[model samples]
Target: MPPSSAQARADTADELVTALDSLESLTSTDPERALASATEVEHRANLIGREDLTMRAQLVRGYALDRLGEVSSGGRIAHEVNRWATEHGHQALLARSHLQLSWFFNMIGDTPAQLEHALRGLECLDEHAPARIRADHLQTLAGALITNGSHEEARTRFQMAEDLAMQGGDVHLQIKVLNNRAFGEYVAGNAQAAMDTADRMLALAATHDFPLEITALDTVASAQMALGRHAEAERTLLSAAERSVGSRGANGEPEAQILLTLAETQRLLGATDRARTTLVRCMDACEEGGLAGVRVGALREQAELLAMEGNYRDAYELHKVFHAESEALVSAERDARARTLQAVFETDEARRESLRFREMSMRDPLTGLYNRRFVDERLDAMLGEWTASGSPFSIALVDLDHFKQVNDAFSHAMGDEVLKKVAEILTSAVTEPAFAARLGGEEFLLVMPDTSRQEAVFCCEAVGLLLRSHDWSTLIGEISITASFGVTSATASRGSRSALLAEADRNLYAAKRAGRDRAISDPTSER
Candidate 1:
């Protein structure tokens, strides 16, 4: 007798989930295959009506598309998933979506947007989150932080990510994190640190019986050269090539990188003929690996070789080709960033999920800023600290300036757009130790822990200026918008939550009465 229908359906569900896992596994090593598998898994999940699985499948598909050079479509998919995940309270999907968006931003060289998304992704991971997923997002955030010039923070994030990866026994993730950390250190001029990190990556791969990480080797060679170890660098490259077992690398491009680095090492070591020969091999590896970026480097290397050989004419010609390729690569990615988001998905599940998510939200649904409930909870603890230890802190009550004329003239939707923009400015202004929250409507509060009254006042003023000078027409057609702030610092008597806010509120009212678009901090006049 055939299997029962119920059993068959259960098996099918499990199979689809398993397929999704396989697709995700192939994402980095073989994106083309991952894309195909993702499509198939998506169909299977949809057929079975597993909304979560479908969302996961779509996210993986977007990642594969991005790796395969379809940035616009992938970004659209990612954004749609993000919106849906946010509505559903699906933290896993939300985290992945932000990670994908960060990737899109990084590809286009939008460091600020990349950093923003990376931070959001890291925020979404909780204790129950899978270790591998947590490590992936954390590692990505570390890279973004480093690129944004926060090396110390980046190092801490990297260490955390690597520790997580090691705990999970994910050898590949460990290698990847170590390699990236090393390269980031090298770029930041920490040569010894880079070498140590690269060495650790190699050690991890060797102990795990995994293929040699060509990228780590390349990083090691670069760090060696940076430390003036010319001969050592050459030896490292040779060992990497031999371990790689020909031109093909763990990934195609890394071998080309190794070859180019070797050629550069030779050139620096005064071996002109050897460098020229190595350059030819580099060009061959580049073509084989479809490494256009590395090919450009090879061309520049060839040009330098010719220049060294007293052939300035040929050298200059090759340099022109290299320059053109370089310019085109940069221009192409920026142009791709201009492709607007064009994805939409609507279902009763999504609609219902939004209402559910909103009910549980600690953050405002519209601006994604923390809501009053979250602020109240945090302030309760903060007040206890202030009452116990007299720990200094400050709060700024912010209110947007308007007479409801703009809302009536331009419609409430446009007014909402203006609010969101203000929220963005406020959100960006707050650093790690400080936070901004939406109390309700156009009212917000900035809480600064361990900050002086003067510092809080300065912060509010800067935010006010940003809002005042912002060209609102870009968001709403030709309009001026500003904000007023009331700042107050924490003290023993003011530790009472109501009293603290009332102080800020009085100052806020004073600012509104005097003139909008200004910050008021009355450290002198107090109860």
Candidate 2:
């Protein structure tokens, strides 16, 4: 006999709630998947007229969205959810909702808002809130305190979180708090304490497949580097990078940092060729992972390498590019922080100014495509979402075929016109949910979220055909422009965003090697 409708609905609601609670485990590791699951819960809960579950799902969705770089979108949803949770007297939901808002504010660099929401979350915590929720709230409060320059209070909060984790026997949470403690110690210039804490974190992380393992290794490597133990630092970072190979990597930061530091160690050892190789690898990973700031580090390393090789002109050029890009990035971050304030104050003037500054900050100044900074942030967000939810995303690295010859044959001014036309064609190929960016010089990267490898390959082929058919002679008589394309896609078992990108870069290189005016995609790696 089938169950009654009431029984079925009750069972379904319980199942969703269980799933919703489990989402916390994946929140830091795979926000995309969490968001997808939360959205599913919201839809099903709404279908059953379960407002409580729907609100709960919405709160989780907001948190996931905030982590995945949709901070503004998450902020709005969290605000609504918080109000609903408060009015309904749902203490647990209210605590979690405040936690979500805190995360959103933290992402946008609004330290005050982060602290406010974190305190609010603590205020709402009661017996109704789970132990894990309380632990998370304490961790957020600690971080907020640190941002507020209250180190002693932050240390106390960390201790409280550690106590809670210990009481709950949550190895994962314990490792997380330990890693934070190590980082805090390092930042406070207590290298020895940081090393000891990192060792403890590593021991705990090794006993389980916790997400903090790579970060613990990084902490150890950082302490070693500070102590001038170059060989030790190099070995530790190598281990960290190896572990990071198949992971999402410490909220999207550890892998690149590990490799960058490893390269620095090699450079210090006077291993010029080895250091150069590592820097190249670092640059590729940085580009693929959309780690623009880390890419700047890679660029600086490369510039240093060139200077050591006595190639002063190229070295100087790279340094100049690095400085300009770094300043632009700082300006962009400041504008983002301002926008967060604007949202809070409900000021139209601040909003308008922020919009203008953002546009200026993201545009390439040439070709009008998004710049490297925008692409990096978007890629980081998309990767977090894709990794979490198992959604598909494709990336294409496009290189203009014979671009140098174009510059040599025609004047640089004429070559500029050709690039502009190519940019126009590339921009036309991307629609909503698809974006293209100039990664400086003659290369561009196109990203399509919710697109599979096959779909992306088809799009790349179409772009190729369009360029081949374009009337380039109209701009420069008898001269034609074409691009080499390489494509890769995300999958459930994908190693890292950098690996996905490196695969695409390899394929793009293959496209160029195969004859120049064609598109080639990594065939074996698709899901």
Candidates in order have lDDT scores of 0.81, 0.80
Q: Using Cα atoms with residue i matched to residue i, what is each candidate's TM-score against the true structure? A: 0.61, 0.60
Model 1, which residues run further than 4 Å from truth?
1-11, 238-255, 284-292, 310-329, 339-527
lDDT value, candidate 1, whole model: 0.81
Models, CA RMSD each: 16.1, 24.3
Candidate 2 minimal-lDDT segment of 10 residues? 246-255
* Leading candidate by TM-score: 1
Residue-level lDDT of model 1, residues 1-527, one tens digit each, is: 99997888779889987888777768887788888888888898888778888889999999898877677778779888999999999988888899998887787666656777888887887768878888889889888877666575578678888999999988988888898899889988999999888888878877888875566678889999998898999998988877665546234566677778899899889899889888887788777767778888898888888888889999999999999998987776555444332222245544563465444346664477887877878788887876777667899999988827666787555766787888899999889668889886689999998788988888988898898788877666677788899999877677777888999999999999997889988756552
Model 2 stretches astray by more than 4 angstroms:
1-7, 208-213, 246-254, 303-317, 337-527
